[model samples]
Target: MKVKIDLEKCYKAGECYYNHPELFKMGEDGFPVVLHEEISDESLIKHANEAIEVCPAVAISLED
Candidate 1:
């Protein structure tokens, strides 16, 4: 799965970071940063989904 983050819509909520720190991180500007572009492994997908679900701003998504 391909993961994308809409930085413009992000409000620096940091939920993604809390849910999946390996896949998502906070930048120096306090915005969400995507650590990976694609997650094909099942284990990684689980973490990615967690990040998407926990994002309060709805800034994270799993794309085709």
Candidate 2:
């Protein structure tokens, strides 16, 4: 699975990082930065889902 975030739709709200600090990091610019493009950890699916659900800008996406 892979995760993608739309910068145009994102507002840098930091929800993704808040939900999954181990996976998402706050970039110097304050946006949620993906540690990796590919999601291999099955345990993190729920966290990713939470991030998508809580994102105010609705920018987070998952691809299988």
Candidate 3:
């Protein structure tokens, strides 16, 4: 699976990076950047799901 963020729908809320620092980080422009685009780890998947739920803009998703 891969993590995909739709910047057009993202509001730069920082929820993903703040809650899951291991999987995401704040970019220089203040947007969240995915540390791992392709995820095979169960723990990372959990974090990604958590990020998706917490994102106010609903810009985060997982793709096969």
Candidate 4:
């Protein structure tokens, strides 16, 4: 699975970071930054999905 974050749509709310700190990072400007392009591990996929779900701006997406 591949995780993609639409930077333009992100509000920099930091929910993704709170959910998956290892997979997501916050930029200095406060936008969500994807740490990895692809998430193949099952455990990590769950966290990535949680990040997507928790994003208030609906900026995160998963592509499989």
Best-to-worst ranking by TM-score: 3, 4, 2, 1
Residue 30 lDDT in candidate 2 = 89
lDDT of 2 by residue, 1-64 (tens): 7778899999888888977897799999988788877887877777788888989999998899
RMSD of 3: 0.7
TM-score of each: 0.86, 0.87, 0.95, 0.88
Instruction: Output the number of the TM-score-best candidate.
Output: 3
Q: Give all candidates' CA lDDT scores.
A: 0.83, 0.84, 0.91, 0.85
Off by over 4 Å in 3: none
On the 0 to 100 scale, the lDDT of residue 64 in model 4 is 86
Q: What is the per-residue lDDT of model 4 for residues 1-64, given as tens digits with 9 covering 90 to 100?
A: 8889898898778889877889988888888778987879999988887887778888889998
Candidate 2 yields a Cα-based lDDT of: 0.84
TM-score of 3: 0.95
For 14-46, candidate 3 gives per-residue lDDT tens digits of: 989988999899999888899985999998998
Candidate closer to the true structure by TM-score (higher is better), 1 or 4: 4
lDDT string, candidate 1, 1-64, tens digits:
7889898888888888877888878888998778887778898888888878778888888987
Looking at candidate 2, the ten consecutive residues that score lowest on lDDT are 40-49
What is the lDDT for 26 in model 4? 80
